[model samples]
Target: MRVHHLAALVLACCTPAAWALESFVVKDIRVEGIQRTEAGTVFSYLPVKVGDTLDDETAAAAIKALYATGFFKDVRLEADNGVLLVVVEERPAIAQITIVGAKEFEKDKLKEGLKQAGLAESRIFDRSLLEKAEQELKQQYLSRGKYGVKITTTTTPLDRNRVGINFNVDEGRTAKIRRINIVGNENFKEKELLDVMVLRTPGLLTWFTKEDQYSKQKLAADLESLRSFYLNRGYLEFNIESTQVSITADMQDIYITINIVEGNQYTVSDIKLAGDLLLPEEELRKLVKLAPGDVFAREKLTESVKLITDRLGDDGYAFANVNASPHLDPEKREVAFTFFIDPGRRVYVRRINITGNARTRDEVIRREMRQFEGGWYSTSKINQSKLRIDRLNYFTAVNVETPAVPDATDQIDVHVEVKEKATGAVMFGAGYSNMEGLILSGSVAQDNIFGTGKFVNLMVNTGRVNKTYSLSYTDPYFTSDGITGGFDIYKRVLNTSALSSVSTFNTDTTGGGVRLGIPLNENDSIMAGLGLENTKLDLGPNSPQRNIDFVNEFGRSTINIPATLSWRRDGRDSAIWTTSGTTQRVFLEAGLPGGDLTYYKVDYQLKWYFPLTSLFTLMLNGELGYGDGYNGKSLPFFKNFFAGGNTSVRGYNISSLGPRDANNRTLGGNKRVVGSIEILFPMPGMKNDRSVRLSAFLDGGTVFGPGGTRPELEGFRYSTGIAVTWISPMGPLKVSVAQPINNNPGDNLQRFQFQFGQQF
Candidate 1:
């Protein structure tokens, strides 16, 4: 067979003037010069079929239609005695793709990205698609401040009508910000304005924070911060005129210039409310936490608008809108704000749909919903329901959406979506603590047993000084009203002879307990428990007098029915990663008359977290404990409270803070106090990761017994330290480095302490 160039055939087929042509009736159509393309595919794209009339107009149309399919580089037509022939040169397919010198992203990830952009292996190759892939690779590097990156693309022809594509990337040094200039600012100093920005020049901390790197997103956010800073300080008309960011010729350094207009400071002269006040006018006025003749602050204005809108939402007006129109007087530099309220239709929840729960039952999630079907849509209740569901910790994520029902103005449907996570674990573990030399432990736990929102755990632990065995179960919804019930049985053995701080003695205790949790409100709860335990004490020859006296007073073997009551209020945004909120707990435990002893211990603790900035938080914690015996008996020596430990006072030895005996060992105290202040932030390079955190803390604590010669406040010690907490694969880990600020003579010291699971 002889193949002729299609260019000449197309030229002769379309032009009737170049060659003589006569219209003929086609008998059949045949495809030629196709290696990879099928003969049927050519016929499908052809406009004319077998037995159709063939002329200059029909032949030109057929030739043009074949080229439009993009399956061939050229197309032509030939007529052989009332038969038409179609020839097509198919485009080559991509056989393989290779990416090299890509250190920032995985090769497979880069290839996947190219696949989405329409250039990948086994796909027909096009020059335009190849160019697009190159730009995408460059754009990804540009996002990481790599301005000096170079990308080269190569295409090689291979056998079997296929081609190979390669992308070679050169990722150069990342650009850094050398200086930042603020122009046209009069009211605020340059240093103050720079302090508020996330982008900055090279500094001591910039190496870890990477704030010195140039990023378009960071610059835009910094400009917005400047506008907000001025507006909140009475600069009502502040504006960012322009921002100019320039890079060095070598693309290694960046300079940013921001020009801002600081308008005159304005004061509020009057305020008014207008338009459709569904609630009482006086009632809405009280919601405004601003006053007349105050500085015109945008922050305050935004708050007032939100208050009114949220109040309306609570009243079932889910689509309410509150707009503030400001009246300005240039001469007096005063502005008056008028709030316009528009309460849309009062909507009701028509249906509640739950989805995305594979292992969990629908009833388990529905029970946590405060918003129900056929109920008026309340924003507060919906928000509370989300929080309650999150607190269950049975799912990785939970989301709710309220979409308006079609053809209904006063009805909507609530859609709840949840992503479930594994809630069961079986672990074999070993840990080491500074006080306990070596510890071995094992546990099996299930937080959502059978998707019914029940909890069960079995644990066994052994150490040089302490050993424990326990089994526990809990039903979060023991009743329909959200009451919690649980029970546990345990046996524990403790020996202080190996410890240097406390008196040398040993105790073996066995017990079982039942507990109940009653919710007083959304943030307040009361917990009560009762249990019976038997303890047998063994005294060593080196025991302190207090321990010996306790054994003589109340026999070596004693039994007690312990009763506990507690109240707690937790308002944190997250129980696991608490960044803001206040928590208070008051706990009391008593040994009742049914057993051999009668004593009571009460503990009070308060913890507060205040956000200092977007990236930092200040936390304060304080605890006080007191214990005493009833019926004129002394507090049990085994039950005394001692303060110093890694969990209490970091720089001091475990249980070392109290009055000492003749052997210079802690005899234990009846009263104790512990307080600490900490600055908390995410660890470097892990700002968005919540599983790890760092803190700088100052701790102070001491214990005092009735026999103490010194005043209650005299024996207090103080320390300062840095601590880190990380959730590792084995278990939770904590490490601290501390320096004792003030320590009395003979007080034990342990400067570095850490606890983490390890295998022996």
Candidate 2:
């Protein structure tokens, strides 16, 4: 058998002038030159049937149609004794694909890229598709500044009419930024403008920050930052004209040039509101935190507009739009801003849909939502709902979308999507302190038990001087009205060997308590609890006299029932990393009248965070406590409070502050006052890093016993220190160093202390 080229055969069969074709009736259809395709497939694609009269036009149409299927590389039609024969060469299937020398990208990722270009394993083999995939792979490497990357493809034929493709890749090194030039800036210095951008030339910290590597995305973002910097600094007409990036022959060095236009600086001459003020003009005017005669800052102008819009959003105006139009006077370098507000229709929530929570119940997420179905949409409530869900710590991410309902202008649907996280944790922690030596702990906790929003924890810990075992549980919505109920049972043993300032004795305490929290408002809450405990004291020959006297007067073993009442107000923007907020608490705990001892304790704490700048925060914390036994009895030796620890005055030893006993041992005090001021900032060379913090702090505190007068004020211990806190994957780690400012004789001091978990 002789096989002719399909293209020449088709051309000969279709041309009447060349082939001299005559109309003929086909009696049977036969397909030849097919290796893998079915004969029926060829017959089905033929436009003319077996008995239909066929002409040159019909034969050409049939041949063209068969080639259009992309299943055949060539197609030809022939006639023999009034019968038509269709010949097709099937495209070979790809048996396998292998990629070599692809170190910059994963083999699977490259395979996926090829697959997207229709050249994967078991797919039809096409030379054009392979070339396309090669070009795309090169482009991908080029985007990473790899200008010297090279890719080559090879195909090998295998048995059973299949072909294997191999891609050889050479991914060169990423080009490093050598120089960055900024032009056409007259007001701000080049260094000042470059300081605000993310992209930079090679520097000392380039290895960790990667700022020396050029990226299109990073360059774009840096350009925007440059624009914002000028716009916020009274350059109202700042513009980025062009950005050019050039690379060396070796693909090792990159140089970038950014051309910008900075117009004249302008000061605000007048500011007015031009839109319909839903609220009184006076009230809306008060929301504008900017004034005339101030520098025309686009950021401040936009912020004022947002404030007014948010104020309206709180009043059920969900679809409000505000625009600030500025009128410029190039001659006087002055500008006037007028805010135009458009309050669209007040939309009501038609439905509230919760999705993407595979493990957690719908009610668990719904309970945290402030917005409700069939209610007027409030932007504040919706945002609060999202924040509340985030604070639950049950989900890794929560997103809320308000999509307007179709054909309903005044109605919308609220969609809350949540990505659930692992709510159960097996925690193991270890730490070392100057006083505690080596401490180890382990716990099993579940924040969302069985997806019902209940919390349970079981913990056992052992340290050099302390051991504890505890079980705890909580139901945040005990009454379905945001009431919190919880209980904790624990057995703890404390050994005071390292804490030499305290008595060298051991105490065993076994206790359990039930507590309830009532929400008074969004930021205020009241908590009350009742507890019963049995405490036994063991005294050594080296015990302090205060401990021995307490044991002699009140027996070594005692049982008491204590009641506690507390009120707390929290206004922090964030619970973990608060920038601005104030938190205050007042607490009181008293022994019942029928208890083994009669005592009452009171304490007050205030914490305020003031944002000094966008990257710095000033935190102030103060605590004061007073406790005494009623009916002329002194405060229990074990019930007294002591200062000086990582959480207290950092320059002193734990429980090592206050007056000494007859044996020169620390005697715990009945009154305590402690205060600290910290200036918090992000770690150096870390951009937008929230997991770690560095702070400079000043700590002052003292403890006073009944034997001392004005000791808390006169004998104040002072310390200044630097501290660091890191939220590691395993847990949180804190370290501090301090120097005593008013060190006294016989005072126990711990200048440096640190706690390390498995994570940090």
Best by TM-score: 1
lDDT score, candidate 2: 0.82
Top lDDT hit: 1
Error of 1 at 459 (Å): 1.4
Off by over 4 Å in 1: 1-90, 93-95, 425-442, 660-666, 684-686, 706-714, 726-735, 743-760
Assess each prediction's global lDDT (C-alpha) against the native.
Answer: 0.84, 0.82
Worst 10 residues of 1 by lDDT: 1-10
In model 1, what is the error at residue 254, expressed in angstroms? 1.3
lDDT of 2 by residue, 552-631 (tens): 98899988788999999988876656799899999999887777878999999999999997788999999999999997
Q: Give the distance in Å from residue 137's predicted Cα in candidate 1 to where it truly belongs.
A: 1.3
lDDT of 1 by residue, 1-760 (tens): 2232346446666664676446789898888888888888888889998778977678778878888887788676777777777766788999999998999789999999999999989888888889998998899998878899999999999998999998989999888899999999987899999999989998888888888988899888888888889888889889999989999999999999998899899998888999999999899988876678898888888999988998998888988999999999989999988989999899999999989888889999999899989999999988888877777777657889999999999998989998776677665443333555544456678889899999998777676567778899998788989899999899988887777666678999999999999999998999999999999999978887667778888889999899999999988876556789999999999999878889999999999999998779999999999999998777788888888767899888778887776566677788999999999999976888876899999999988885433343238899999999876655557788888898866777777777764211
